[model samples]
Target: MNTAQLKQEIIEYSKKIGIDKIGFTTADPFIEMKNRLIRQQELQYQSGFEEKDIEKRVNPALLLDEPRSIIAIALAYPSKMTNRTISKKGERRGIFCRASWGIDYHHILRDRLHLLEEFIKEKVPHAKCKSMVDTGELVDRAVAERAGIGWSGKNCSIITPEFGSYVYLGEMITTIPFEPDTPMEDRCGTCNKCVDACPTGALVQGGQLDSNRCIAFLTQTKGFLPDEFREKLGNRIYGCDSCQTACPVNKGMDFHFHEEMEPDPEIVKPLLRSLLQISNREFKEKFGPLSGSWRGKKPIQRNAIIALTHFKDETAVDELIQVMNSDSRPVIRGTAAWALGKIGGEAANLALEKAQQVEKDEEVLNEIDKGLSFFCKDEVGQ
Candidate 1:
């Protein structure tokens, strides 16, 4: 059979295996993407999680030998939960963003790509294929955009006409010289909703992001979150969805095609207090499957403290006091101290005063001081 027949079979087989969308493109160097990446690095706009080598990221040949074509795939995730958990007066909850809703997309996309690799190998015994998901060197969005999967939206997410911006992208570089699909035209004309909606103004301009100020990036950090972004975090425990949620295109786009992509409401939106003292094993057992938990329980726990502060749930003060006084990690302890101050009460103030006497870490002491300052401000106002 010809390469065209093989390509057709791949497309048909992709549908059978739950690949929501597939497109093909030549394995040419992404010239425009390279320039943009260089600019992002120059401006310090890139998330440090990306591969450091710019050449390797934009060049398919660097990743695969004699690469002739690339296949891009997208799997749509649910924007709305079916059995959504709601937060109430005493029982406030923290949220993991929709991207982290279900089982980690990294695993799900890899399973699909592995199947595709096997199918291609059977057709052409000597065919070469290299696949990667979000963690890959080749930018998944760039490959997807080039393969006509979707147009890159202003929010820096691929926006498909059918699925909006709610899709997880993956790609495979293959030696087969299949015909490339025409890229979709940019449909985000005159829409700045995503940019305007960003809580920390991380979306500096259309298609450009300053990851340092991004809530999504901030939530994953394992430190005392900067004071500026802390309040902006609201109740987000892992990732922020302000920009995506504000996109007019993504409105009402909720697909539950893959069962693995379905979110467990309890895990994604757990009670804020419960996370404060969760054991390491308990956290892993509950959240390890979700991509957001990759940073371990520290960041999530820290964010949960901030979330408790966001709600000003006085009930959480006791737990926050425990975390502030006894947590092993200084970052978590310091953040809990800061949160305790934010949720000021007699108990929280007494805890902070006691912590100041014994806390050895200078950073934690500073946070304890900052927490006490809130009470000072409150007293002066009264």
Candidate 2:
């Protein structure tokens, strides 16, 4: 079969295997993306999670010798969780962004790509292919954009017309020179909703992001969250979808095509207090399967403390005090101390004062001092 016939066969096979969208692009170097990446590095806007080597990130040739084509695939995830848990006065819950709703997408996308790789080999026995999900040297979004899977929305997501921006992207580089699909036109014309709605102004402008200020990146961090973004975090425990949720294109876009992609409402929107004292083993058992748990439990626990404080749930004072006084990680202890102050009451104040006497970490002690300062302000105001 000619390249056209092979491409057609691949497309048909993709649909059969539940690949929601598939497109192809020549594996030439991504010059534009390389330049943008350099600018992002210079501005200190890139999230540290990205592959450090800029050349390997943008040049498909570096990843696979004599690479002639890239096949991009996207799997749409559910926007709204069915059987959603409603947080009551005493049982407030923190949310994992829609991206983290189901099983870790990396596994799902990797499975799909594995199947595609097998299919490609069957068609062209001599075809050499290298597949990667989010963690690959090549940027998934850039490959998707080149393959015309979607337009690079101003929100920095590849927004497909069918799935909006809630799609998981993966790509495969192949020696076969399949016909490249046309890149989509920029459809976010004059719509600044995503940029304007960013809580931390992480969306510096269209198609550019300051990941340091991004709530999504911040929520995944293991250390003490910067004080400036604590209030901005709202009840988000892992990832932030504010920009995507604000996009008019993604409005009312909810697809539950894959059962594996369906979210367990309870896990995705777990009770804030219940998460505070969970053992590491318990956390891993409950959340390990989900994409949101990649950073382990500390960040989620810290965010839960902030969420409780955000609601000023005085009932959580006891739990926060326990975490502040006894948690092994300084970040957890420090954030709990900070949250206790935010949820200020006589009990909260007393806990902060007690923690200050024994806290060994200088950072934790500083946080304890910051927590006590809240009570001082309350007294002066009165």
Candidate 3:
């Protein structure tokens, strides 16, 4: 078959496999993206990259490891799934971003790509193919845009007219050359709601994302969170969608009905009280199949405590005290102390004294004292 016919067939088969959009490109623009990465590294924005690897990202030959056409695919995720309201009560809710709410997209898309690869190999016996779904060094977004899938929005997400920014991207790199699609026009004009709505100002100018202040990265990081960013984290225990939520293009899209992507019932709008009680075994069981489980439960449980502190729900004092006194995780204990201080009252003060008496971690002890001061009266009663 001719390149045009092959491209058309691939697009048709991709749609049949449940992908929403498909397009093709030469994979040459990856060089420019590599240059951009080099600049980012030079500017000290990225760490642990040798200059050679950065150059490789821009070379199409290096991306595919062979000269071939590229196929870019996009899958629409339900927008309604992202709007679930989590409760501050002790019940605890799991908050999975709509993109990651259901089964892992990597497996789904890779399976389809394998089918396509088999089809191509049958047609051209000597053809070679490789596929990736956000797991490679190549810039998928740049290739997707070049292939006419959609334009990059101001929030650094691809925006398709039919699905807005609620789409997941994947690609197949093949030795068989195919006709490429025409690039799409930019639809986001003069709208800065996404930038304005970012709680940590992660979206600097236009499409640039500062990973340092990104709540998504912060929540996913494995260690103790910096205090400054914790306060701004709000109630998010997983990924933060404030930028996507504020996009005008995504407005009015119902994401709640996508049952496949629903948050695990145990974690759906979980209460701070119950989140504090998650054992390591329970943490593995509850979040193991989900994306946020990569960092284990400590970071998420700690985030829950921060959110509870922000809520200032005095009713959570007992749970916070329990966490502060008995939780083995220092980050959780420290955050619990902070939350108790925020919810200061007679009960909280009493808990703080008890926590301080037995706390071995100096950091946690300091947090207990801080909580105590908020509730304890001065001798002068001023």
Off-target runs (Cα >4 Å) in candidate 1 are none
In candidate 2, position 53 carries an lDDT of 99
Error of 1 at 14 (Å): 0.6
lDDT of 2 at 381: 96
lDDT of 3 by residue, 87-206 (tens): 645443446566666656676677768887887787788877778877566677888888898898888888888778887788887888787789999978888899999898888777
User: What is the C-alpha lDDT profile of model 2 across 1-382, one tens digit per residue?
Assistant: 5999999999999999999999999999999999999999999999899999999999988989899999999999999978878998999999999999889999999999999999989988989999999989999999999999999999999999999999999999999999999999989999999999999999999999999999999999988899899999999999999999999999999999999989998899999999989988999999999988988888899899999988899999998898888888899999889888888999999989888998999999989998999999999999
Local distance difference test, each candidate: 0.93, 0.93, 0.73
Give the count of colliding residue pairs in each prediction. 0, 0, 17
Better candidate by TM-score, 2 or 3: 2
1 or 3: which has the higher TM-score?
Answer: 1
Model 3: residues with Cα > 4 Å off, grouped in runs: 46-52, 82-94, 255-259, 262-268, 369-382
Residue lDDT tens for model 1, 1-382: 4989889999999999999999999999999999999999999988799999999999999999999999999999999999988999899999999999889999999999999999999999899999999899998889999899999999999999999989999999999999999999998999999999999999999999999999999898887899998899999998989998999988889999989989999999999899988999999999999999999998998899899888999988887888888888999899989998999999999999999999999999999999999999999999
